[model samples]
Target: MGIHLHKLALVGAIALGAFGLAACGSGSSDSEGGATGVENPTPVGGSWEKGNFLPVSTFTDRCVSPRSGTDPITGSAYADVLGTRQDENNWLRSMSNELYLWYDEIEDKDPARFDSSLTYFEELRTFALTPSGREKDRFHFTEPTNEWLSQSESGIYIGYGVQWALISSEPPRKALVAYLDQEDSSLPDAITRGAEVISVDGVDLANGSDVDTLNEGMWPAKSGESHEFKILPLGASDPVTVTLVSAEVESDPVQHVKVETTDSDRKVGYMLFNDHIAKAEGELIDAITELESEGIDDLILDLRYNGGGYLDIAAELAYMIAGDNSVGQSFEHMQFNDQHPEINPVTGAPLDPTPFHTSALGLADDSLKGYPLPTLNLPRLFVLTSGNTCSASEAIINGLRGVDVEVIQIGETTCGKPYGFYPLDNCGTTYFTIQFSGANAKGFGEYSDGFVPNGPFGTEADLPGCEVDDDFDHLLGDVNEARFAAALNYIEGGDCGDVAVKAFAEFGTSNRLLESNVSVPKEISRSNRIMVR
Candidate 1:
């Protein structure tokens, strides 16, 4: 399974002084009786508000509690105290207000879903806040606070260090290894990309009855668990059995960076930018610096598998690519809920647009701070994308186009996410709720269905590019690979041959065939939601 590190904006600095008085007061005693003589009380954190307080309950007790109650202060019966608690902390407080986008309809739909017994994260799932009507707002979720914090600091995850693609979903349910992390030494040499799965843990993948077992083996719930797989390498006739142990693996976001001359003798700088984490900022700078020295004529940004990360990094990359053209332009304009439309929720100030940043941000050390960014200064950009290209990656495309740079999008449609948030930690879970939507300088951010390749006739949001399917037959960086070849062909005023078009057509038609027969591993297929720091 692939490891994903979500892009999260750091929480805005809290005014400790505001909570100083609240912390000094004793917490309200239980209504039933005086406090028991328990010596070690749980350490308290954050501000104490009477409405936010509730009797803590164990897991079993919490599930059986009443769904609604009267607030002592307001003397009003409420169905959603969990919702109220979230409203107090969520950047977009309007979600809890009477005028929320779906307020009337959702209240009539299923009010029970908002009960306190249900978690705040679960209640957010019931809201419809996205303009796209596709429920793009539903990507909000939570992860273990420790896990979220650790992965944000260091891109490490517990997994088998392999990415899988469901190539065929007929009765046999075939899956192919997409890529293996080169940084993980624990992965065996036999488990290479393009290897075909025969069976998992003695359960025949060809047998429909064992589908559940196959999925469990492929995506184990915990690390150190072992799974044996029968696999066939690219040209092997006989399947070999290998046991893989899931372990902690570090992901390198920039997998490949190089310069290659095309058939037309144009030097094309290629970069496989997988994510927008802090580490990626320095790596991208290094890649661009090298490409600048070599004097490349064009750039191909491969974001085929990038999920997303920090917004600041996306702004930096746009500035690096567009150079002086992006200096005075808005990279993205964040739009909050209607209630706080004119204010920045995180900072409590008037909405300030984020411009193309010329320097690195949020790095632990002062190195690279205010350092001049390198630029290719090209009038056009070639961005390679897939269904996996999303969030901050999409921001790069929108941000560049905002500055009027020609962005030629290659490959399939992007994941189509324009919303972002600052992850909030409550209890032991880190919650991610969509707090703001973003637009480019042209005021266009409505492509929630995703940006498709522009073909002969182009849509308003489309770019001049071809929709080429991923070519697993050839390695990603190879010049003959379908998507890269299409980009090169377009650049040289050539057309993709009939054979390539036919192949892509077949691939698109067989969407069900490629769809996973079982659930995809969460680490590999996690939703692309940007968390603002």
Candidate 2:
């Protein structure tokens, strides 16, 4: 979606002819780019220097793999020209320097030191640390246009219909099938939620040294790639090995919707929302409408595995949850670099606070627009979260908190990502660079360290909630799931439970707790706080 040319903005096409880049026609990059050599090798950024720079337009559309004719996605003419590693890298350098939120903090390293555009683009970010000493700009990265379009637009990916939960990534590791794509009917019956991954192929996952084989088997590069997995099925005494072939798995973002009548007679609505993709706009609306009909006493949104996609979707979700309390309130406001303080450098529009859109966004189909969204009008809400609850997921908590809507969080700390950018494509490669940081109403956006459960409530980034570990023993949205149960307990008791945080040393890692609760596939796991321009 390179900051998605869905709108197909012509970023000053005259510059292409001025620099004479159009003559370099139809050439493509064969380099499996990294800090590596190239197929069509040329001097890296040949004559470029560290401090000196050019207009961003000078190298725009100059691609290592330039396309011709019409683009199928946007129906716009392809504006690419064959270019070298230098042109591609230079464009990235100039683009980052001109529009990046922390452009001054970036080191203007010589592009000549980088061999491919990918390697050079990778290093062109501010190496600054947040107040918590965490990496400030963890969102800068790129993706192939083909893969990005399919997954971002349709939530499609090539895998075993499994969403892994990595309790420990290092050796003597432990992994579990945290969630499964309900859309995948071909998945083996034993590969249910809470199933532990003992090994992949013939290699011992707990103590094996061969990293490449394990990665390929678990997350195959393409479809029809079959691999053997030794799994310890949930509630089973013995482990069994099963062969799973990777296929195109489309995720059901909003699933497990039901109205639960608690013991105390409160009808609580629950849902397991995983992604914030385009289709979620309609699915969420449908879910909310369904929940409203049941007269739910309270709502618990399970967002533990939601890494985030579209900001508009988050804003819509906020509006649906808060209802009349959100009138005249801003969902989030954008803050750009010092150079473009008053205007969006990319869209060339006035800088403004993005309000909570009451109507459907029509992401999947244009005909779906103009319909008023159904609301719950609940005074308070509950969100089930974890380390994978990031970006737009975190925005929901922050935006709701900004409006004084009580958000009782249950689970570990949420992944902090308040920054967002438009995925921009240049010469076939989609680049995701942080261009803005968003603050909800009351202007509180500095949650780079993440919101914590049971954290000091007085702090802008802290919230009132219980600290509970993710329970893989039960499926998400189940009343017995650790986080969901904690939410239910809080509704009845209004106090945190005595659930002491525990670690799994039995899984083999010397480290007790998981590095991340939701295992992210590298293919689709980029900084997901995507702002569609």
Candidate 3:
């Protein structure tokens, strides 16, 4: 779940480690009262005071060092790693330490010198490998402990292994701040900002109050570019120094507005869903409702950025789309660890004897039916896809496709991570991927690269004449009825040509291939499994 990272105690993680301390064993005095008879004093736990975090109005909005990727297949594109500055690595290492993980020994065969980000990533790897059952309480995962161990051993980045903690010990006035510094010469300036508070009185950001109280003015962007967010102490002198950890830019919004001058008769709804988080789903529905009111019909559901989240949200949205069809169909099914029970990974105590299982939309009793929505024999539905669309997102796309939904896909591929995660907290670290099995509709559970989009993954639909309504964009007291009319006409059946496609493509669906050059794996099944829950 991409959004789940922010929802996880991420802000808390930033704040709990907000205070910087000198190295622990560096000859610090821990004298009770008078100096110890011994010469150098032993270091004690790191100390933090009530530090104030201020808003950063001035930022070094420069570019960042370039990132290098290798061609795992041919090794032809191997290049030395960039962005290896000591400060950058230092930041990542600091974050890793905050995660309570350590750096595993680096390989002599490392592609390049150990930079900060890589160093931090290495620390995470180490923690994943040599987890001292004692420190496992820091991280959180949705997968069961056994599954996590298995996947971790395989060394994949399927489920995000995020950890959460508290930021302040005081009566809740502490804030966690993040800064976006894009001052490297290698890459373009791509950092942006947004804000969300986790608690007014020990509440979580997902509960709604925290986000409502967040001061949105703290971070500004370059014109239309998007930025991430973080909260800080009331008055921290250096706001830029406190970096807010976030996912990539492509994974933020669930919906976008694209308008152009084309007159294509097709009115498509391009909706990007990057996670199954309920809050984000709610936002997505609200956006769709708004669009519907504005007169939009045909839609493109973009799951390219989704990583997965609460399964219930996925089911609900599917039901809304399916309408009455969900009544008899099984959209998706989940599996649980009903097998060998080990000592509870968390407490080392006996675990619950029974495991839990549910459909993607959960279950239905005789009293209440589940997902009672009928399928809208809607128009062709194009699902813009990519390698990042994972888990529940994959489930929805794969399931819907089984039911003869005109699920046109335009994307490279989907991330082959379909198992559900059951959260397990042990000691202080939270263990994810603990227990989960494959979740598919009826016949679609083969793992490999989940769901390869059929046909060419082309750019989004191009429709013209859908510019921002003049009434909304103009300051004139008179309404721009013509602008509204144009929007309406385009939604009904007007073609905008390439300009329309280009506008929609800006939302990141242009790169998907109609067909992949790479060969599909045999392990990845093509059978359709449509489930209705």
Residue-wise C-alpha lDDT for candidate 1, range 414-470, written one tens digit per residue: 767787766543333445666677899999887766777773434446777777877
| 1-533: candidate 3 lDDT, tens digit per residue | 11111111222223311111111110111112122233322222222122221111111000023213432212344221222233232332333333321212221122113432222333433322211132221122222222222222222221111111112212332222211111121212222111223333233333333332222212211223232333333223332222333222211235453322325544444444544543344455455555455444455565544556555556556654544444456565444333213332222334332111122222222222232322333534545454445566666665554444545444435555545543322111122322233443445554433454332323212111222211211211111222223223434444211222111111111111121211111000011111111
Top TM-score model: 2
Clashes of 1: 7
lDDT of 3 at 397: 61
Model 1, position 448: C-alpha lDDT score: 67
Best by lDDT: 2
Q: Which of candidates 1 and 3 reaches a greater TM-score?
A: 1
Write down the lDDT that model 2 would get. 0.74
TM-score for all models, in order of appearance: 0.76, 0.89, 0.38
Name the regions of candidate 2 deviating beyond 4 angstroms.
Answer: 1-3, 6-50, 499-519, 522-527
What is candidate 2's CA lDDT for residue 382? 94
Ranking by TM-score: 2, 1, 3
The collision pairs in model 1 are 7-309, 8-531, 9-531, 9-532, 9-533, 10-533, 421-532
- Clash count list over all predictions: 7, 7, 78
Q: After superposition, how far is residue 370 of candidate 1 from its true place, in Å?
A: 2.9
Which portions of model 3 miss their true places by more than 4 Å?
Answer: 1-253, 257-264, 294-297, 337-380, 455-533
The lDDT values for all models are: 0.59, 0.74, 0.32
Writing each residue's lDDT as its tens digit, candidate 2 over 1-533 gives: 23243322423221220100011111236342322233554433347777776776767765565677786556779776556667777877888887789989888977656767777776888888888777788666677666777777768888877876666676667778878867345677789888888888888877787766777777676799989999999889899989998888787789899988878999999998888888788899999999999999899999887878889889999999999999789999999888877877777778888788899867876777878999999889999877778888888998888888999888767778898887777777777788899999989998887888888755777778877877778767778777777888888889755544332211101111223322443234322787766
